[model samples]
Target: MSGANIERREIFRAIGELAYVVAKSDRGLTPAERQVFFQIAQEELDYDSWAAQSRFELLDEVIQPSIDRAYNDALHELRKYSAYLTEDIKEKVMTVLQRVAVCCEGLSANETFVLDRVRKDLQSLG
Candidate 1:
């Protein structure tokens, strides 16, 4: 794949993993909660193509082993590209993280873990 395609794949994969982390944070993935994750993944990451399918597939493959590890890894990947993102994109990332925190009806333990890692990762971008 081209360099840009590789980067896009990485970003989309991270978003998908984030979605999974949020959806599974409550220990169960409800349809409504899944929808929230899907919407954020699509709209925020701009993965509105067939590539989204591949990205999600990768996330499904990697996220199950350990949610916290996947989220932290994804956060590190996102931080690497922070300088290339616009202010709007950065805000969208934050929005998605917040949405994930509440995807399980409320802040569950897993969601809190993800949120804390996300907050620390984003803060380190400065």
Candidate 2:
């Protein structure tokens, strides 16, 4: 793949992993949260919801084996890609994460904690 395409894949995986973390944070992904997840993917990432969800499921498969380990790994990957994120993309990322944070029945502590860290990380990005 070309460098740009490779970067796109990496960023998608990183962000998709993040969305997974939020969705699964409380041990279940509710229908509302799922809607927000795919909404972001479709609008911001130009992906159909179902297709984006397939990729996200694939990522979760790779990461869900060890939740704690997966979280640290996702955080590292998120930070790594922050520098390459553009202003528009950063806005969308934050928006998507925020939507994920609050889209369920209500905001869970876990989701809030994750969102706080990610918000700070995105803010520091170039």
Task: Report the lDDT tens digits of candidate 1 across residue range 67-125.
Answer: 67767777777776665545565566667767756755688887777667666666777
Local accuracy by lDDT, each model: 0.63, 0.67
> TM-scores for all candidates?
0.67, 0.75
Cα RMSDs, all models: 3.3, 2.9
Can you tell me which runs of candidate 2 are displaced by over 4 Å?
Answer: 47-52, 61-63
Candidate achieving the largest TM-score:
2
Q: Which one is best on lDDT?
A: 2
- Local lDDT at 98 for model 1: 76
On the 0 to 100 scale, the lDDT of residue 89 in model 2 is 63
Lowest summed-lDDT stretch of 10 residues in model 2?
Answer: 47-56
